[model samples]
Target chain A: MYYRALGFQKDYAWASHDDIPFSPPKIPLSQATVALVTTAVVDASIPKPVREANSYPIVDVPDHFDTSELSWDKETTHTKDRESYFPINDLRARELRQEFKALAPRFHFVPTEYSQRHTIETDAPLITRHCLEDAVDLAILIPL
Target chain B: MTARTLEAAGIATVVIGSALDILRTAGTPRVIFNDLPLGNPVGKPFDRDMQHRTVSAAFELLFSAEAPGAVKTLPHQWSTQDAWRENFMAVRAEDAATLEALGRATQATRLENKAKGLFRR
Candidate 1:
């Protein structure tokens, strides 16, 4: 749909795989360390231009990050409310409720790219390395 | 794709998204699909209760999903009717020219970024 809308000659080929990865939680939700990864670039405006993957300390996460440059359903909705997409506060409240043990020290920001190879081979490994370094037991991905 | 990679690397993962068709084929381990606008997947902006509920549901799927490729569709809707779906990313005839130019510029930027090795670890 997006490809056609963007005037591409053929529909974009979304990556598909037969050997889907599966890993059961190693720790109970009450004790697991959680991390967040989103498609929202951090502190980037249209002029600043973020075309790479990055991570920031969760405590340093902005109340709002720029999304005006990203592609989404801008007609019906807006990203003014950070909690609507980022949900750092909501996850913090959950941590207090003992829903999870703790939030990882850092949250990740991955750019939206057309190349699945870059995502699987480059970006994913970078995020996975960060998760391991933070000792994150579970990760929740929220893409805008 | 990151979820799949993370899970393969021994960390459990769950996705909260609004694009069902894309998520379905992406081979994600666990997903909570919200039938809302693209930008507001967790819930409507400023609606704290809805946002909390959506996150809670994603956690539920995380704990309960026994196999890979598990997906649960939340009952939330963007509106009373399905009008939003019809207009979602719908290209307008007048906007075609602008979109084409924007697309070309975006491709050029991507190529420049790639050459710079911006995403390489």
Candidate 2:
């Protein structure tokens, strides 16, 4: 579907070996602070300068941000519908239900136009630092 | 890279995306690959129940996945091929002319905003 969205068909090589490593949750989710992150280009609800930085900028999840730029049909997810990609509201609902100990103070939004190199080199570091600074115990990264 | 780095830093993370193959290659520790459309991974966009389920299911793996690079698929189907095409084909052929024009205009604005770091972040 992603390739079709880009109007093309291509082969993607999958890793035969599960090379990615994992770390168990340092603390139980019931006692951890959780955060949400996405590469959906959701509206930042901030100034243009801050939003358009040449380098990746970890911005706050704006209240009622627009999800139009996302690859999905905007008609369904307009400004009001965010669960399509940014599920902060769902996460919050879970929190209200005591699904987790607490919600991170902020959520993160990254542009979809970033190059893989940029994402690995620039965005990854900033995102890592931001998560660490926020003391995020668990994170949900929804890629578009 | 972000997920791997964060997990390496001792922060548990889960990736919920459609491109499971790409994500697996990228080495996402915990992944819940929903075979849904790109933008509507949580479900059919506005359906609160589906979105909530998707989120809940993804979070469930944070504890269930035992090994590094664990990947799982949710048993939810977006549609029975009747309405699924609407997602697969973003714009219908009949409405191409009209929608394409509007899309071009919107794209211009988005590009300008992106260059200026405005609009969607």
Candidate 3:
């Protein structure tokens, strides 16, 4: 769909796998440390038209994300409400209720890279290291 | 793609997305497929009830998914009419030339950024 919409000469070859990686929760949900990963970049300092993969502190999650530059269904919906994408406040309330152990100290941001190799080799490993360092047991991936 | 990689690296993941075809082909481990627009996957803006429901559903899938590649579609509707699907990302004839130029410029900037190794630190 994007290939035709973007007027690419050929179809974008999407990555596929028969053996998908699976890892069951080692601890119960109430005892798991969960983190948030989003395709939306949090830093407004990073100029438009240049998408980069990075991470931000969960403590400073913005009230709204500037998404005018990214591609999405803009006509139907907007990212005016940050919780609609980030949901840090809701997760914090859930944490108070003991729905999970705690929210991770930081959330991760990954760019929607066209190259699957770069995603798998570069971005994925960096995020994996961050998750491990933070001792996160689960991650909720929200792509915008 | 990062979701699967995270799962492989021993951290469980649940993807909340609206693109079923892309999510399925990508082979995400556990998916909470929301049949809404691309950007607002969790729920509509300022709809706290719907947002909470979506997050609760994600947690349910995270706890209940037994195998890899498991997907559960959330029962949420964008609107009563299905017109949005047709116009979801459709480029209007009037905006075609402008959008094409923007796409080219964005790609050029992306390539230049990559060449200069300008990843956020």
Residue-level lDDT of model 1, residues A1-144, one tens digit each, is 556656577888887776789999988999999999999878574233335677889889987788877778988889999999999999998899888899999999888777777787778999999999999999999988
Say what the RMSD of model 1 is.
2.6
CA deviation > 4 Å runs, candidate 1: A45-50, B92-121
Candidate 2: list runs displaced more than 4 Å: A1-18, A42-60, A73-80, B82-121
Candidate 2, residues A58-134: lDDT per residue as tens digits?
34555455555456544333435566777877777778888798887766665554345555666666777778888
Displacement of residue B85 (Cα, Å) in model 1 is: 1.2
- What is candidate 3's DockQ? 0.59
Clashes of each: 0, 1, 0
Q: What DockQ results do all the predictions give, each relative to the true complex?
A: 0.63, 0.42, 0.59
On lDDT, the stronger of 1 and 2 is: 1
Model 1 captures what fraction of native contacts? 0.76
Candidate 3's displacement at residue A74, Å, is 0.8
Cα RMSD of all models vs. native, in order, equals 2.6, 5.6, 2.6
TM-score of each: 0.90, 0.72, 0.90
Question: Which candidate would rank higher by TM-score, 1 or 2?
Answer: 1
Candidate 3's C-alpha runs over 4 A off are A47-51, B91-121
Candidate 1 residue-wise lDDT at A105: 99
